[model samples]
Target chain A: MREMIITNNPLVVEKYSERVLFIDGSVEQVLIKVRDMVHRKHGLISHPLPASLRVLFSPYRSVIIGRNNGDINPLQVEIVENSILKYKKHMDVREVDKENNEDYQMIDLTLLESALKDEQVNSMLSGY
Target chain B: MKLEIGRIHIKDIQFGDSTFVEDGVLTVDKAGLIASLKEDERIKDVQVDIARPGEKVRIIPVKDVIEPRVKVEGTGAGFPGVTSKTTQCGQGRTHVLYGAAVVTVGDIVGFQEGVIDMWGEGAKWTPFSKTYNVTVDIQVVEGLEVHTHEETVRLAGLRAAEFIGQAGKEVEPDEVLTYELGGMFEETAKYPNLPKVLYVEMMITQGLLHDTYIYGVNAQTILPSVMHPNEELDNAVISGNCVAACDKITTYQHQNNSVILDLYAQHGKELNFTGVIMVPEHTTLSGKLRVADYTVKLAKMLGADGVIVSEEGYGNPDSDLLMICKKLEDAKIKTVLITDECAGRDGLSQPLADTAAEAVAVVSTGNVSHVVTLPPAEKVIGNPESIAVLAGGWKGAVLEDGTMMCELNAVIGATSEIGYHNVTCRLY
Candidate 1:
C-alpha cells in the first residue's frame, strides 16, 4: 500500500478501518501497484458498491488508497484503475452559489476504501 | 447455431378472394382473417384493413406491430410457446413477409399507445408508415379487465401475423440472409485478438401495460439470464408493452433488431460478438439492484470486454441501465448504453430519470417530449379522440381543421432504443 493523498479533512481518514492509513505525500508510487494487478485472474464474483460511493468517485481524475504507511491493497488499486479507464471526458465542477450553505468538496479516498470493505462484508453476510 | 432467413419482399397489399402472395403482391381474404380472430370469446368484433406507403391513412392508438414470420424447417413454427408449441427457434429455415406488418389498433390501454400516419409529416417519424400494414382494429368484450383486454389484442396481432405469414411459405424469397454464431471457445479461437462484446437487453417487465415476453413467459417473472442472439431474430422476444410509443421496441424491431444486425456485420472482423443477456426491468428497488448486479456478474463471467445495453420503457428503467453500467464499468468492462430521452418540451430537463458518470458512452434515440404537428389524414383508421388522453398528447391535440398536434412520444418507433431508426439529438 504505497500511496499519498492530499486532503485536510480528518473525517475522511476516520472513516477507514485501523488497518488503512493516509500518508502525507504524493501517490505517484501507487502506479506500480495498479500495473501489477492489471493481469489478475478474472472471476464471476462481484460486490455491489453503494450508489453514494459511485457518485463519490464519479468526478475524480484519479483515486488512490493504500494500507498502513506505503502498502497498497491490490484489490483497491484495481477498483481505482477501472474507474479511471471508464472516464469519457471530464468537465469542470459546477460552482456553488455564495448564498447557498452547501458547496462541493474533494472526495475522500479512504471513504471509498471503507465502502468497498462494507460491500465485501455485506456480500459475505448475504452468502454471495 | 445457424438460421437462414428467407425474405419475401411484399410490394403491396390488397383484399381479394383468397389469401396469397402473387408477383410480390399480398392479397388477403379480409373476411376470413377477421373471422379467425373472432374465435376468441373475449374479442367481440374485428375489422381488418390495409394501409400502404404513401397513402393518406392514419392508425391511432396503435398497440403493437408484428412482422409475419413462420419457421419452414426449424423445430418451432411461429412464436414458440405463444403461437406455437414450445420448441427452439433460430435454427433451420424461416420465411418472412419482409415489407409487411400486422398493426393492432384498439381502445387505449394506458396513456402509452401510439399513432401511425401513412403519409404526412408524421409518416416520416414512424417506421411502420413505410411497411404495408394490415391493420387489425379489435373491440374487446365489454367489462373485460384491463389486463385481459391488452392480452387479447396482443395475441390477436400475433395470430394475424401468423396467419398472413402462411402465404409466404410457398413463395420464393427475393433475398436470403443467414446468421450463425459458434460456441464461446470456438469464437474466441477464431477471433483471438478482437474484443468479446455482448448485448445486455433490458425489457420493460413491470406488470400491466409494460411487459415483454420470451418464449411466451412474461419477462417480469424471469431473472437475468443469457439468450442466443439468433433466438431474438427468430421471433423469440415479443413486445407486450404499451409504453410511450416513440421509444418502445415493437415486436417487429425485436425480430429485426438493428443493433444485433450491425454487430453481426462487425463480427469476426472487428469483434467477437458474444451473445445476448436478457435482463428484466423490475419495479421494486431491491429487484432492480438484484437484477443489475446479476447482469454484470454474468458479463464478467463470460469474459466480455465490451457490452452494449439497451433499455425498453423509460423512467424507472433508466436506473437499471445506470446501475448495470456502474457494475460493468467497475468490473473493467467498457459499456455503451442506448436509450431515449424524456427531456421536457423545451428540452431543458434531464434526459433520463437516473444518470451515472459511468454511463459516459450513450446513444440517445431522441427526445420524446418534442412536440410536432401532423395534418390529419384523409382517413383515420382508429378512434382519433383517444389522442387527447394519450401519454404524449393533450385534450386539444386534434385541432379544428382535422390537424393534430402532439409530442413525438405518441409516434411508434420514432425513438427506438434498439437503434432501428436514425433519429437522434444534439445539445444546443
Candidate 2:
C-alpha cells in the first residue's frame, strides 16, 4: 500500500524524503491539505487528531495518508472533517504556542515515526 | 484472584539518617536515596526533597508520581516486569505507604509534563498536592534523546517507590482491604440474577512518549487483553506515556485505580464485576477499529450486561472511545464512557471530537481546557520556566510576582477520566 506523510515538520521531510508532502505552514495547514486530499479518495492511514489535547496547540503536525484509487471513504472524510473542526475549536482557547516550536516539531516527528514504525516491522516480516 | 492490601497512614515525610516510617512520619535518608538513584549512568544527579500539605511548594515538569508499596505475600514485587523479575502480581499481601508518594521531576521531555502545587489554590486542583510528597529531582545526562530521557526518569520513580516500599514491609497496616473475585463462570454461577459489569481502560499507545506497560510488555504491541482486576491492584500495569498530565494515568493511579476500586466496592452487592479489558488507543484508524472490535468481543465473552469505558487522553481518543462504545452497544452491551471534556476555556466547544448515538451515558471528568490561576510558591522544584512549553501553558504563563496561570490540561490529575482527582461539577 502506497502512503505519504503530510507534515509541517522539517524533521519528517528530511527523514522520509520521497514519501513526504511537506507543508510549509502550521498544523492546521497540514490538516487542510489532508481534508482536501481525502476528498479525492486519499484515505487516512493515521488518525487526524493528535493523541492528547495539549499537542493540539502545537504548531507542527504530521499525518500519514494512503493514496487510494477508489471512491472517497465516508468514514475517512468524516474523521478528517471532524478533526479540522476539533482543532479549530481547541485553537479558540489560544493560538499555537510557537515559542518552543522546536520541541513541538520534534514531538510531531516522533508521532510520525511512531506511525512508520509498524510499517517497517511489517515490511521486514514480509521479507521485502 | 484474591489480594489483601494493607495501608500504613503516613502523616508527614522528613529527611533523616535512614529511611523508615515511625509514628506515621516517614523519615528518609536523603543522601542515601540520591546515591542509589544516581547509580543509573543516564542520570547525572538526583535530589531528595519533601513537600507536605499546606506548604508553599510547587513541583513542575513532573514526570510520574508513584505510591510506595511492598508485596509481602505475592510472587511479583516491585512492579514485576519493569523493575523486577517478570512474575504474576495481584495475588499477594501488599502494604502501601498510604499517604506518601514519590514524585519524579526533571527537564521537560515533552510538551505534556504537568505541575503539582502543594499549597492554597493550586492544591485544590491537583490530588497529588495533598499527598506527603518525596520529590526526586533527577538531572539526566545532557543531550540525551527525549525517548531515553523519559524512560530513564520513569524507571527512577519506580525504583524509588520500590526502595520506599520496603519501609512498609515490616510495619503493620492501619487497615487491610481484601479484593476477591472468582473465575467468570464461578462468579456468574454465584450471582445468576445480577448483571455482569466490565471495565474497559483505554491507554494512549501512540509512538515515542505515549505508551503503557503491562507486565513489562508494551500494550500497543498486543491486542486488547482481559486482565483480572487483582492484576491491576498488584502492579501489573504502569504508565510510560506523556499524554497530557491532567488525564494521564500516573503509576500511582494505576496502583490504586479509582475505577477498579469503585467497581470492587460494588463487586457483588449490585453488579457482578466481570473483569477489565486494557484497551490501547492507537493513532491509526485501522488499529482503532480492530481494538474496538476486540474489546466488544471480550465484553461479550465475559457475558457483560454493562460496561464502563474510561479514556486516557483526549481528542483522537474520543473516536476510539465512541467506536468501542458503538460496538459494545451494537452488541446490546449497555455502555457508559468516562472522559474529560476539552470544552475549551469558556466551556463552549463541543465536549468531544467524535460522538455516537449509542453513547448516551457519558461521564465528564471536568474540562481539560479550563484555565486556572495559581499563586506563586515560596519554593519551586524543577524548572519554573518549563511552564512555557507545557500543553496547557503559554510563554507568559509564569507571571511576575511568581504567580502562575495554566489550563487544567497541565495540572496533574485535574481532569482524570478514572474519577481519581478532586475536580467535580455541582449543579447550582
Candidate 3:
C-alpha cells in the first residue's frame, strides 16, 4: 500500500516528491495534518512523534500516513490523537527552541527515512 | 555463552606520553588517540580533557558516554559490528577500566545533547560524575552535513574507547566478575521449579541520533531478537542517541546494563533467567503493532512466567511500552515495567503518553520535566549557552550569575529507565 509523507522537512520533500505533503511550518503543523487526515479515516503509517521528546525542539518533522479504506481505524485515530496530546503536553511546558533549523532538518529527514524502511518489512511479512 | 570481566579500577585520568593504566590511574596518549580518531576525514579537530570525581568541571552538550574495555582472551573485537568485524562476543575474558568513561562532547547536532557536572549539586543527578571522565570534544570539518557530523562524533568516541581499552589488556584487575548464561533449555531445566523471567529491553530506533545498535546492526532494521546476556556484557550493544539525555541508555550503560546484571545475580536462585529479547520502538502505528506483537510472541516462545521491561527514551515509546505490557499481561505473563515520566514541572500531568489497565506494576525512575537549579561550575568544558536549546532547557535558562536552571531532561543519566542512576520514586 502507498503511504503519505507529511513533513516540514525539505529533505523529505525533495526525496519523496510524489507522496510528500509538504507543510511549510513547525513540527506541530506536520502532526496536525496527520491528525486531521486520521480523523478523516486515513490510517497512521508511521508514528507522529519523533523518537525523542527533545526532537520536539527541532523545527523539522515528518510523519507517514497510509491510505484509508472505507471505514476509519479506531486504533489509528487513537494513536494519532494521542500523539498530538503528547506533543502538546511537551510543548505546553517548553516552546520549540529558538534555532538550529538545519541540524534539526537533517535529523527529521533521517527519522523519516528510518520509518520508511518499515515498508520492506511489511512486504516481507505478508507471505501466504 | 559466558563472559569473565576483569575490572582495573581507574580513580583518575591524566594526559601523558603513553596510554596505559597503572596503580589506579589511567595515563592517556592524547596525541596518539586524537591522531587515530582524526584518521576519519570527517573529524577536523579533536581535543581531549579529563574530568574526575569531585572536580569543579562540567562537560556540557555531551553526546555519548562509553566505558573502556578490551577482550583479553576473546577472539573478536571490543565493539563488534560497528567498530570492528562482526564476531561473537562473550566467549572469553575481557578487561574493563572500571570507574571511568569516554565522554563525547561537541557542538549540538540535535537539541538532545546533555550536560554532566563533575561536582556540586549537578553531580548528584548524573551517574557520570562518579566516573573518571576522558572528554573527547570533537569538531567536525566545516560544511559536513549534520547527520554525518553526528556519526563522526559517535564513531570517534567508540574508537577512542577501543584505543583506551587496550590499556586493560595487560593490567591485573583488582576484581574479576563472571557472567555466564547457558542454553535456554539447559538453564530452564536446571531451575525447573523457579519462575521463568524474561527481559524486554525497548531500544530507541527512530533515526540517526535516536537509535541503538546491536552488534553493529541498527535496531530499526531488525526484529525483536533473542540475545544471550553475556554478549551485551562483553560490549555488543552500542548507543547512538541525540534525542534525550536523561533517560537514553549510553553505550557505557549497555555494556554495564543494570537489568542484565541484576537478572544474572538471581539467574538460578530467585528465578529462571530465561534470556533477553531486544525490541525496537518504532515510529509508525503499524510498526509499533508489529513489534509489540513480535516481542510478546518471543516472550511466550521462551515460556516466560514473568518479565522485566525497561524503556529507553519516552513519549512515543510510551505507547510501545504499554502495548507490549498489555499483550504480555493478556498472555497471563506477570510483567513489571521500568520507565520515566514527563509529568510537567510540578509533576502534575500524567506520567506516560499512553496507559493501560494491564500495566499494574510499573516503576517510575523520575520525572523528565522536574526542574532543577545547578550552581555555577568553575570550569565549563563545552558550550555553556547551549542549554537554552536543550530538551530540558529554555530561553534565559543560563541565568545572570551563571547558575543554570533546567529540567532533569538536560542532565545525563538523571532519569535512566534501566535503573542505572539515583532517581528514586516511592508510592505510599
Candidate 4:
C-alpha cells in the first residue's frame, strides 16, 4: 500500500494520482509500494470532477479492516462523491462565531464527514 | 425453511451458522423462512415446516404464521424563505427555514433519501441544482348586503322632503307639486303636464296670499288644516288693517281692498283654499290636478312642502282642475286652479301676451290676491339673455321697460318673503 499526503483543508485529489509512501517517521524509506487502481480509467483532470474518485490519503488514520462479502470500493467512491457534491453545492464551510474565542474559525467539516460515513455504514448494514 | 407466527407468513429467512441472544430474545439471521399462503376456499388444510441449523426440522399446522415485507419511506429538510428581523446582506434573495425536507417552490435541497438512481423532470439529478415547487393552501369567505328599489325610492323621497323642509318655510303649492311630480316624473316621464300644473298652482296660491294674512302655505295643500280646511268660515271679519299694511300697494286699491274683504268674509278666520283658482293663461297645465290623492295625503303627513297632480295630455279638456278645486275647498286649503289655456282658444296659436293681465284682472275682480299668468311665446318666453330676467321677474316687478310681470314670485314669496311684489320667478 502507498501513502499520499494532503496539506490544505478540504484538499482535492486528482484521479489516478501517484505518491510515495514513508515508514514510521522516515521520509526517505519506502514502507510499501502502491498506486491508485482506478487511475487509468479517466484522463487528466482539466475541470473539477466528483470527489468519489479522489482518495483522502491521510497518514494518521489506518484503513478500515473488515472481511465482508460486499466490496467497499463501490461504497467509498459513490458515498464520498455524494458527500463532496452536497458540501460544495450548499457551501457548507463558513466562519462561525464562538464564545470566549478571539478569532472566527471555520466550522468543523470533520463532523459532517463523520456523519456521511455513519450514513454509509448504516446503509450497508441495512442491506442497501 | 418455513417460519410462522399466529397465522401470518414470514418469508425468505435463512438461519446463520451462529446464534446470539440479546434482551432475552434469541436472534438469528437467515435461520428460518416462510411464504404467505393465498386465500382459497379449497385449501382448508395446510401445514408449515420449520427447520433450524443442526436441528431436526418439525412440521406444524399452518394456522400460525407471520409475513414480513420491506417498506421504505424518507423525510428531509431544506431552506425555503427568510424569517429574520435583520436585513439580509444579499440582494434578491430570501431565506427559508424548513423543519423537514419539503417539496416546495424555491427550496434549496440539502438532503434526500430512497430511490437515488431515478432521473426525471422532478428528480434532483442535474448539476444545475434541483428546484422544489411548493404550494400553500388557503380558504376565503365573503358576504354581501342587498337593498330593494322600493326602499331606495322611499329613501330618496324622504331625503328630498327633509332637505326642502329644512329651508324653514312652507314650499309653495305649485312648487311643491312641481317637485313631487318631478320626483315621480324622474321615474316615469309619461305625465308631462302634472309638474307644470303643480308649479302654476303653487305660484298662484303663493301670489294670492302676498298681501293677506296667509303665509307659509305649501304647493299641494298637503296639510288640510293649513291649506285645506274641512269647514268654511262664513261671514268672517275682513280686517282692513292687514290689507292696508301691504308693502307694495298697487294703484288698484279699491279693487284689491274689496277682494281682500270678500275673501275674509267668505272664508272667515279658519278659511282654507285649494287648487289653482287664479292662474295666468298659457300656464301649460292645471297645477291643481291630483293624480294620487293618497300619496299627497301621505306626503302631507310626512311634512312635505307640497304635492302635485299631473294631467296626461295637451290641454285642460280632460282637466281635473274643478275636481282638485273642490277637494281643496273641502279640505279648506287655499286652492289655485291652473289650466293650459293659451289665449286664442286654439291650442296651436301663439299664447296671448295679455293672458296674465286678463287672469290677474279676473282674480282681482273675484276678490283673490293670488293669480299668476304664464307669458306668451315671444313676450314671456325664455331667451338665453333673459334667463335672469325671467328668474327675477317672479316677484311682481316693473321691468327696465316699465312692463310689470311676476316671474318666480310664487316660490320666493311662499318661502322667504311676503307679498307678490317680493316673489321672483325661477325658470325650470
Tell me the lDDT of model 2 at B245: 85
Candidate achieving higher TM-score, 3 or 4:
3
Q: Which stretches of candidate 3 lie over 4 Å from their true place?
A: A24-26, A120-128, B108-112, B391-396, B426-428
Q: Write the per-residue lDDT of candidate 3 for residues A1-128, one digit (tens) a residue.
A: 46788888888888889988999987788888988998887877777776566776667778888777667888777777787887888887676764677777777777777777776578568741
Instruction: Give candidate 4's error at residue B288 in angstroms.
Output: 7.0
Task: Give the true-contact fraction for every prediction, in order.
Answer: 0.00, 0.68, 0.72, 0.00
Among these predictions, the greatest lDDT belongs to: 2
* DockQ, every prediction: 0.02, 0.63, 0.63, 0.00
Backbone clashes in candidate 1 total 6
TM-score of chain A of each: 0.31, 0.89, 0.88, 0.26
TM of each candidate vs. truth: 0.76, 0.96, 0.95, 0.16
Q: Of the native A-B interface contacts, what share survives in model 2?
A: 0.68
Question: Per-residue lDDT tens digits of candidate 3, residues B1-428?
Answer: 77889999998889999999989989999999999999999888888889989999988898999999898896667688888898999788999999989999987464545899888888999999999999998998989876688788889999999999999988999999988888889988898899999999999988777878898887888889999888888888888886688999999999899999999999889998999999998887778888999999999888999999999988779889999999999999999999998888889888888878999999889998888888888887877656556533455667788777888888899999999997775679
Off by over 4 Å in 2: A119-128, B108-112, B390-400
Clashes of 4: 74
Q: TM-score winner between 1 and 4, please give it.
A: 1
Candidate 4 lDDT: 0.20
lDDT of 1 by residue, B1-428 (tens): 99899999999999987889999999998988988899999999998989999999989889899999777886878899998888999899999999999999887332334889899798889889899999999999999876788899999999999999999888889999999999889999999999999999988775556678999998877889798889999998998876557777889999999989988999999999999999987644446778989998899899999999998866557678888999999999999999887666677666775667898999888877677888867887888666554422234666788677777777888888898864755679
Q: What tier of docking accuracy does candidate 1 attain?
A: incorrect
Best-to-worst order by TM-score is 2, 3, 1, 4
Write the residue-wise lDDT of candidate 1 on A1-128 in tens digits: 22323232344455533433343432222322333433332210111121211122222212223224234444434433443322211111111111211111222242334334433554577675
Per-residue lDDT tens digits of candidate 2, residues A1-128? 47899988888888888989999987889999999999988878888898787678778889998867589898888889999999887775576776767788788888777777765655476575
